[model samples]
Target: MCVQAISNPRSEDDQEKAWQAVCPLVNQLRNYYEFSIALEAVVVDLLSVLCSDEMTSRQHLEMQQSLFKQFAEILDFTLKFDDLKMTNPAIQNDFSYYRRTLSRMRMAGGDDIDKDLDVNNDMANRMSLFYAHATPMLRMLSDNTTKFVSQNKDLPVENTTDCLSTMACICRVMIENPNYRSKFSSEETVLFCLRVMVGAIILYDHVHPVGAFAKSSGINIKSSIKVLRDEHPGKVEGLLNALR
Candidate 1:
């Protein structure tokens, strides 16, 4: 219902209400492992809506803060979800089942297709843009989190550390897994991973007292770099650009 309301709001007020209603739900749902795929689909849809060019300038201005908050929430959930899925093999099985079901529904010309699981072309395009190197979402995450830490000096750094560590882990997993590396056929996907890996290292350095390069850092930076160097010898330019 919240998704429907957000997608086809009857009024500007209604749209705002829908976003307000769904933001917390998005945040909460990340903790539930069984709903990982559902949460992933919802995040993609919400991002497409949030990043749409159809909104008027005035509406965009009015909702700027809300948009940032939503993006932060989405980013947080994404990192947490990625971390969970890395440890749980069942998440992939669940996603495979969903794909099979969606495929069957498409083949049957069924009207009963699960709207939540099915991503339309437009949404997929927007999702692609979101992970691109030029994405505004990355800038937003950097700016918002920097400002947040500056203002909230009393807050614990553990959460931020965990987020960065999860990013590093994701980068490592992608580099180590041949199947995952094969999926990075697009330059954008490769750049996206490089950017995350680089950003994670830099931020992890700043946040962790001993730095991300320390022996006790837990993040295997040396091995990750070695794997990238050995496997992706051709992506040197992309890696340099990402580091820069």
Candidate 2:
């Protein structure tokens, strides 16, 4: 309902209200791992609406902060969810069930099926792009989290350390897996992986006592770099840009 309101709002006030209502739920995604697939769909829907050209310049300016906040949350959730899914078979089961149900609904042409459950072409494209590059979103998250930690020095270093470590590990796993590396068919996706890997290394170096270069860091940085370099010889510009 909130998504519908935001997508087809009668007024600017209505859309803003819808977003306000939904933002809290989005912020709590880490607590709702079982529903990650469904929640991901919702997040993608909202992102597509916000990023679409249909939004006016005025709305873009008005919602700029909200948009960035949403992006950061999406990035964090995507990484965390990917990490969890790697360890938990249940997450894949949930996604399979979701796909089957959606397929059944389409096959039956059920009028009773909620339109919101349907993945429109635009939303599908957005979802693919999100999992592909998401560099812009990662940058937003990096900037916001840096600002936040600076403002809240009293925040536990352990919490920050764990978060950055998990992000780095996830990036390494995705890059090292041959199947996953094969999916990086686009330059954009390759660049996204490089950016996240480099960003994670830089941040983890700062937070981890021994630094990301340490063998005990558990990041397997050399192997991951080797995989990327061997698979994407033409991505030298991408790597250079990531370093920059």
Candidate 3:
């Protein structure tokens, strides 16, 4: 039965049916890290199916948002552990799969990867619901950085690095995609976006390359730090060093 669902999803209806059939199994197994690595990949691939551009309806995008929300919970489950060792290779592979699928989605649904995004539009509000749910997952990255550092335990620095790399890749896609950028003009979204970027910088190496996208993200992070100069100068400076 599971094989039928996973083997040949034929249409939008078929994909949705496959997801419905497979999703509950993913949720039930996600808690067992050692046993669920392959399950995670299969589930994330199903997510890519749901997010495909052929759906082409506002309602389909809403379904995509819900799917991402579910993925975020799975990520949270993966990170709920106290240390990174047990999670290392499985989590790394999961994130790598995520990067590939999201990049495909971005290119399929996005604009020129090298262009600057228009700041005037709301980006179909794909981001409107996504960031709200994804924020907690990003925060888990931030918290893990500090926790690992403070413990003086073996820091799986690469875990944070992989996440920032995945995020930077996604950020580049967003900044380059006009629809995605339109959502950033809202003050709340703008600030929240900078907070996550800056927090990652405080934790790891530079994940983005020389490009308009990276430059823009850098500018926003610097500006946000300046605004909070009086409130958290030390952490702000830490972010600056991370950027450098």
- TM per candidate comes to 0.38, 0.36, 0.26
lDDT of 2 by residue, 1-244 (tens): 0111123345758745654544443223223432444554554454344434544433543566565345435554444434333344433333333334445555778644545533433333444344333243333344444544455466554445454555556566776777987887875665566555666565556555687778897466677566556655654444434433
lDDT of 2: 0.49
Task: Give a tens-digit lDDT track for model 1, residues 1-244.
Answer: 0111124446758745654544443333223422533444454444344434555423443566465345445554444334343445433333333334345545776644435332433333443343232323334344444544455466455545555565566666886678998888776565456545665665566657687778998578787576557645554443433333
Better of 1 and 3 by lDDT: 1
Q: What digit string (tens of lDDT, one per residue) describes model 3 on residues 123-216?
A: 3133223222323333434454444444433534343344444433443345445788787866444333434444444334332233213554
| lDDT, each prediction | 0.49, 0.49, 0.39
Considering only N, C-alpha and C atoms within 3 Å, which residue pairs clash in candidate 3? 123-179
